[model samples]
Target: MTITSPSSEAPDWPQCAHEADGRRCRGRPVEPYAACLAHIGVDRRAGHLAALEPGAGLDLRGTPFTRDLLTELLAALTDPATGRHRLGPADFEEAEFSGDAQFARVDFTGDVSFDGAAFGGGAYFTGARFEADLGFVGATVARNVWLDGVECGGGVCFNKTRIDGELRLETGTITKSAVFRGLVVGGDATFSGIEFIEPAVFMETEINGTAWFDGALFRSDVRFDGARIAGKAWFDGAEFHHDARFDSATLSEDVSFNGTRFVEGAAFPGATIGGDVEFGGNEIGGDVTFRKATFQRTTVLGPLVFPRLLDLSDAEFQSAVTIEAAVGTLHCRRTRWSSTAALRLRHAEVDVSDAVLQFPVSIAGRSHPFVADGRELEVPELSDAPVRVASLRGADAAHLVLTDVDLTGCQFVETVHLDQLRLDGRCPLASPPPGLRRIGRRPVRWTRRRTLAEEHHWRAERQGADGWTRAPGNTDVWGPAALAPVYRQLRKALEDGKDEPGAADFYYGEMEMRRLDPDTPPGERALLALYWAASGYGLRATRALGWLLLAVVATVLAMMLWGLPQDDPEPVSTGTVTGSRVTMTTDKPDPVNPQGSYGSRLSSERFEKSLRVVINSVVFRSSGQELTTAGTYVEMASRVAEPALLGLAVLAVRSRVKR
Candidate 1:
């Protein structure tokens, strides 16, 4: 066949153009050199070209294809009697058109292919399955490209097909490996339900819109690390082998790896998936990192098990996240994790913050259990991450409620600060493993008890004046007394008060005394000894007047000096006589003065002076009137008990004048 370049002067070709156009030829004779407009010009239809019979391997080696020639060749191939199906570089190349080109089912026996075809318009291969190893290896389509429900055998290669519009490879099957490496799509590229029996490559593709690989199965690695996507990239239900990577790529919209099965491994390290990463049910094999990648939205990775590490270091989540379950450790070191909702580190190994550590009910499966071993979670290398305590001013932590939770062998690294942590579990001791090294190597067992015991004691001390006092008076008097001597002595050393031991000390002393004499009646012995010790007198005085003996002596001293004296003859000094030898006078009998005031002023002054001398001398001589006076005074009080009781009754009645 004589292959020629289509000319502008030539009539329109009927093979390549749409048959819907009137330019379509009704009949076409097989001619090597045809002048019919149906087989000549750029406007010709591809469906009108006559089928050429195969002849000793026909070749159109140097023939360049115009839009008209391509249309004609395509039309000729549609005819059965034409006996020709194979076409090559002799046909379409650099084809230009204003509309889409549809090539429904048409058989080509030989290697009929478009090695470097460039379609200015959209191209469609819907249901027009290729039987042989079809090749459109370096095709470029200006508009959208569709190959829906098409089948290709012996490996199809569109290694560098650049599509200006959306590229759809829906429900297609590539029996062998399909190569689309370095392909560029200006719009979205979808490969939904497309089966690749061997492997597929979409590596290094630039997608202007979403690049969907939903429901596509890859028997090998499906890499997208170097692929640039302006919109969201979805791989929901896509399987990976060997490994897959989106590392170092920029995603402008949300990126999903949801339900993707990573049988071997996967990596998205340093890839910014500007929106949320919904890995709701993904199975990850190897280590994954969003390390230093910024997520502008929530990154939800619910109920996942990564066999190795999953580092989210320095990643920031703009919204809330639900990480209900995680099998491996999630390192969120130095990350700015803020969420309006409660940040759940439930059951997941969370390594962040310092201040205090609190486990959640979700971790315990009931209420939050206080595990003493949690303090070991603190890794000093991450000291910069301080726990954020929201405030404790008006908000009461007591109001926060919780449920029962288990605390079986949980480790809290450092202090886990929480806003409000409620514990309803039993007090459990810290039991470290045989091989694990304790943090700081602090006396783990002793320190655990000491810490908890100190806290408990401190709180109890605040609740009352006693430390861990079960009831108001549950402890022995001596128990408080032991503290009293020390505290009182300290307080007395500070204040200007008597150096005498406090009353609390007396009670404590009484307890010690009773302990020495256990056979004694406890109440009687304690009360009796306490009274005497408190009174600073002998036991006799203590039993007779209790503590009231001190009051009696004070009253007596006041009355003697301040009350009226007898107005009869005054007795002379017995030590001195009336003679010049200075003998002591025994008595002097004097009649009452007319004014009944003889020696009254002198006597009163002498009496006052004498009483002062006596009182001072007595108190100073008898341990400051704390011994003899105390006993005598208490005995005298017992003697006037009846009259005193009667007087007290009258006073009590009189004191109730208002009532």
Candidate 2:
């Protein structure tokens, strides 16, 4: 087909005006021929080839070549010295090759372009050198395309192309952007040490074999969203200057992003990894998310410096995984770990709310740098913040272990197996509000105790008060009846750990809950109230001793007023003349109860006698003193109640100091 300009006559330096597939040729005409050598008649093509020498510059822009025609052209440019076709400043933009285009080891001393080109068979440019820009935008290769070790001075574009077989561009440097958007390789794709100076785009690309991108440097943003790799992908030691995205991508085999530096953030949300994943030694400057991603094998993600968040919300891990990092936040909400997992973090806030753990999982706070797998991860010096667990609501904690993690704001309501959960080191829980408070002019002092965040929220909501902070994202406030068992189980766990002192606070919390529980029977509730008021459920030594002292004083006063006598009575003899004999009779006046002068009855002498009687009653001994009916009953009651109070005081002391 021929395409001519609008002018009636061809101007000087006339254009070839050749066209095919809706694309017009831009090649210049050959002397003594109307069209360029590629578009000239079959008979004249031999004469043009005779005039061309090896390593000659060739421009066949928009040419449509059959298998025989391309073979003849390449044969004319064959260099005898290296037995390889050599070209200079070659341009095949918008060209169509009807058969296998084999240009292996072809050295182009200047710029080259196969841009918008179509090859019916395999296109080989292996070990070739393009001193300038290399373009293959909108190209289609029916079979494999090899450009392995092909160096380009400028940008490289294979954007929106398809290759039926393997495509390799290993160890090639592109000074500008490396655009491969919407590209598909039916076989293995290899890209190693390809220093992409500008943004690299591989969005919606698919590779059938191992996608190797090891040691690559992307000076700008890179994207790989909607891509699918059938085999393992390695991006070890790769660095991205800006953000990198692999959202919605799928990898069938093991993938490694170790020692990668993402100057900005990196995201892989909704991606699926069929095999193991290794993502250690990374430096991420912004937030990195793997939300909703699925990992089929063991995954290790950390030993890195993450300045911002690492979110794995809704992600699924099928095998064992370990993460050790100094990150800002690690969000694992709704994440499911089918096997064992370990998280050793520093300066990070973790939220595992609604997460499912099928096997044992441990979350620990590291104060200093730790060595893992023979490599020492460096900890940031500016912040020694502990790993704070913000929430564990709805989590199955049957096999969860926490070590030195701060839980001051962690919500534990609806958590499963909370009683069986293991806590090691200083796992700090929230403390009750400080100082005494009043409820409607009644002085109320809460026992200082470590409590859960859910309890705090419940109390605040129940009282409609403001001092207590509510848990984030938690609107369901449990009543004391529901919280009582939670406190009881936690207390039991501490007791089992031989932490009696630590368990003391939990015991107090349990009793408080029981006392406030509306569902408790009246008798039980009243009993709990008395237990608290007397000795704080046998955990308050001072309260028990105070009640004991009050009982002793009241007993002494009762004896002084109603039991001590006014004075001692002496026996007298009386003589009667009833018969001829003199008879002597002895009469002892009964000891009278103290009466009339209240001041005399309350004298120091009477007080001394009353104190002796009261002390004897406390020890369950008889004072051998006379008493009124009321005083007798008072002494009996004091003997039983005072000793019991003393015992409670001693029990409280033991509970506090026990190991």
Q: By TM-score, who's the top model here?
A: 2
Worst 10 residues of 2 by lDDT: 1-10
CA RMSD of each candidate after superposition: 19.5, 7.1
Question: CA shift at 534, candidate 2, in angstroms?
Answer: 1.5
- Compared with the true structure, what per-residue lDDT tens digits does model 1 show for residues 227-299? 6788887888887765676676777787777677777766666666666566555666677777766566654
Which lDDT value does model 2 have at 288? Answer: 85
Count of clashes in candidate 2: 0
For model 1, where is the 10-residue window of minimal lDDT?
A: 445-454
In model 2, pairs of residues that clash are none
Residues 1-659 of candidate 2 have per-residue lDDT tens digits of 12222233433345676777665555456667768767887779898887788878887765666778877887888899888777888877666677788777777777788876778788888877676777787777878898877777677778778788888887877777778888889888888887787888898898988898888888888999989999989999888888898989998788888887788888989998888677677766778898999887757766655668889999999889887777778899999999999988876889999999999999998877655456755536427667899878888888788999999888777788788778899998887777776555665666677987778888777774445666456367888887887888778777877888988888888888888888889999999999989998999999999999888888888778887666655667787776788788998777777778766678888889889998886875777776766777887888789889999999999999999
Off by over 4 Å in 1: 1-71, 78-98, 106-116, 131-138, 283-287, 299-308, 314-325, 333-346, 351-659
